[model samples]
Target: MEILESKEQKLFARNLICVGIDKCENGDFCGRIWEPYDDQPFKFTGINEMVIHMDDLYDEWNYPQRALNERSFLRTHEMARTNIIRDDGFVEKIDRLQKMRGEIGTFIVQVKFRQHATWQGVVVWAEENKRGNFRSAMELVHLIDHAINKGLLIK
Candidate 1:
């Protein structure tokens, strides 16, 4: 999968919710995609967390390694593609294509899906890209509200 970082906010087709308004150690706020449609909690620091979550998803699917484009899955499997969001309101798309089979090893490879950047501006890109369908979104909101009410979302 390919990753990208940009100040353009229209980069992603889906927008996650701002569950926690708390800032990180760097004074930047974080938004959690509580349910990234897969029941796995996806937390991203700024926008790069999108990459982190996708990478984790890759690991969960391949088990021990990420999907290596034409060298990861078999010829009959479908490619996995998802559009990531950018801080500038743009889209950063990641496409994982055909996986290769029958080669094994235990060396861990580090994947880089982000670029270097410093906080030079403030746009609060989490203004859009609302995720999930109607019912799902409502369920998420209700769940988070319940959690917050029960002191589960905040301490």
Candidate 2:
């Protein structure tokens, strides 16, 4: 994968949602997720939590507002990706990307498909320009963790 070292390099295809991963103070992965049309990034703490949140978001998006069971997904689908309505004045995509890259262990993620109760996507280690494919959400988290550890070692 190409390293997005310049401002002109678009993170992914315009359609795919791009997620930025940063190492938190306690060594947990902090996620900054950006949908296509939305300028504000949705922040999550751990990788596992982030995965679950994304799944919830997806479910809520595809289905009605009614909650299934006790877990309630945010009704953010209407505001995400779809450009029918615009509340925000301008897009801050570049700022978010730059912030992610400034972190200790930066990763750019683009989830392509969700099937069999898990995620399948590609992740890029920003500092090293390394790319990896994940078969499942667990695998995705493991890949990010491994990259963070490897980055620490390299430094």
> Candidate 1, which segments miss by more than 4 Å at Cα?
1-27, 36-40, 46-50, 62-155
Q: In model 2, which runs have C-alpha deviations exceeding 4 angstroms?
A: 1-11, 25-27, 60-102, 152-155
lDDT of 1 at 142: 37
Best by TM-score: 2
- Clash number for candidate 1: 21
Q: lDDT (CA) for every model shown?
A: 0.28, 0.56
- As a whole number from 0 to 100, the lDDT of residue 140 in candidate 1 is 32
lDDT of 2 by residue, 6-75 (tens): 2322345333445576556476778677654456778878776777666655544542222233323764
Please write out the lDDT profile of model 1 over residues 1-117, one tens digit for every residue. Answer: 111123333211223222342334363335443322333334556534533454444433332233244334556455354433322432221111001111110001122221121
Return the TM-score for candidate 2, rounded to 2 decimals. 0.58
What lDDT is reached at residue 149 by model 2?
Answer: 66
